[model samples]
Target: MDITIEDKFHASCFTLKKEDILKFDKEDNGPINNVLIGIEHHCYGVRFFDDRHGLSVEMFYINGKGLLKGDIIQLQVRDPQYYQLLLRFCVLLADDYKEVNALIAFNTFQNKLRGFLEKRGIFTVTSLELRQFKGQSAVMVSPSPRGIVKIDFINQKEFYVDFFNKIANKPIEKGKEHVYLMVNNDTGLIKIGRSNNPVYRERTLHSKEPSVHRIAMWCCEQNIEKKLHIIFKDKRIRGEWFRLSLADLIEIEKFMDSV
Candidate 1:
């Protein structure tokens, strides 16, 4: 239950036990690695770019067994942002167990995970591609905004139901522009205005729309509402959509204030 990679080109080696392998698998339960073991026998080796650092080809292995001695497998690694993108892509592109298993397997065989990503409007980065930039750091820049957000009335409704269910400490309803920090199903952060375009802003949260900062984006995406509550704006926040519940509106207002 261990996977090892002999970095033939770089002359480095990596090893991990089954538990560690499983941990990575839990992070992404795709067959790209798992199938490498059950079929190809050894985790396939990939040479990838860590965009966080300038372009260097690093070696990674998918764990299994049976890779032919001296056989070479090419691979790529993108920044952590790409990792989140892949998670969502895998779910969207492969909705069932079989489709998921197949595509994950195919992605390994094609050795073009980078190219595949780029075609989908997701720019792939290499250390070399990054090194060309000025004053680069390991920090990630968000992707361009999609301008579309899937507001979960269910979650919003539940928030209101739970809020009014309380005997005391009832949230006050007010006529003001209230903004809240909301997270999409993708765990992307957004500043939802009681009136502005929450969906559109959510899309740009990654790329350019600039209302919320990095910390606020991180907080909401992590589903930690309590920490977000203290940042409520005591002032009137305005936007176009104003019929939202008091609790939900206030929660959003607090988050906006915090930001």
Candidate 2:
């Protein structure tokens, strides 16, 4: 089988014999599978099959023009383990194309990729949703292992900083306190408070009420406790405590998005 991969940089042709395809199939204990390859062009297709029954063939089409401006290479693998293997294969084949390796790394291991990008002053925002609130555009960034974070800043760098701060669990700076929403594990009650020292505050709350746990915290400049108190006045069970409800939680999220 002959395979050709053409990109903006160069054109290369690769040939795989019937024995080689059989070897791979035998090792994986599966028939030749189809894998999707994507780059700048839309018509490219890649396929694999056995040749003994007049079916053995592996073909990939690559445009000779190479990568142009705004070109991104994408690969889709259905199997998780195969995804990793294909990524490694791509890295080897596209050894000179740094962007190809980067795209694979980002899609395969997003958390690790984000960490790497952040160290080098590059950031990616995923699951971003924009909403119109109070006649203003509100941007909501949903980072994994954390709740949605809303910020009013339009600057990309500042937005990345705010998003990173939340995901990293870094301490809130003085005068840049956070409005935390916690829940009592035993009683299922919600607690809202402001704190610059969240760790200490969480410890203190646990000491006072051993069954309480910090659920989520939002970084905000203003005193959010006051506004939250007024909004959930009816649901308030006691000082800084409210009866947790689905409606109240949705309202809380909306409030966060607005700020």
Candidate 3:
């Protein structure tokens, strides 16, 4: 199956297929180009090409680690406008598929693409966003409508405040601090921390530890990390590290909702 989005200026299309998905395990031929793994959704494979006209993206499902056996969709966007709408559509699709929890980017453009998604109420995790190619870091995102709405209202009051903050390297407001929970999907270990700039923090953490995989962050006004640490003191394996438990995860989600 295929879906296309076009306007007078450009055209974009997506193709879906039911085929053997690529595995990134050690046995496979070098990793698929620009692979993005989603905990809830399947995985994505992205490729970029440019010519005299402009830039284009070829996106597809690279693996089925978490999804049921069915048709996987591949997307192609020709330019910026098409790319933007296509990504919004992708988020809608992701919302429908619980398995998709992250979007993968291979190149600079895709990194920016994921950033755009992040601004639209979709949050990202550091562990799930991987950069196969040695270049700039990839932006890994998860959906958080509350966070998105908050950011949207902030941007409206002060246009591009988020974007400028990143570029200008401004300090994140102490009052706007967010407490984040990072989970290692492979080992099932969790880390609790706080940051005003979660994305930058994720990039730094990814650079320091390649093993970290899935992350969940929630914004709060209070110092919740210390409180959480005390609450899970018995389960603490080390500094800010704890054994995985459903109770803790549930509590964390509930805290996010309250704050």
Please, what are the lDDT tens digits per residue for candidate 1 over residues 164-216? 34211223233322233442322222233331333344456646533322111
TM per model? 0.22, 0.35, 0.33
Give, for candidate 2, the lowest lDDT window spanning 10 residues.
148-157
**Candidate 2 runs further than 4 Å off:** 1-171
Worst 10 residues of 1 by lDDT: 146-155
- Tell me the tens digit of each residue's lDDT in model 3 across 1-259: 4444534213333434333343322333334322324433344444544352443445544444544332222343333344455444444334444333222122223554455445444454332233343386644344563332111101111212231232223335554787766655434467888878766776787787765532566566547888888878877888987763444566766765676
Candidate 3 stretches with Cα past 4 Å from truth are 1-175
Q: Give the clashing residue pairs of candidate 2, or none.
A: 7-66, 8-66, 8-67, 50-55, 50-56, 51-56
Clashing pairs in 3: 40-99, 40-100, 41-99, 41-100, 121-148, 123-142, 124-141, 124-142, 127-213
How much is the lDDT of residue 94 in candidate 1?
A: 27
Candidate with top TM-score is 2
Q: How far is candidate 3 from the true structure (C-alpha RMSD, Å)?
A: 14.5
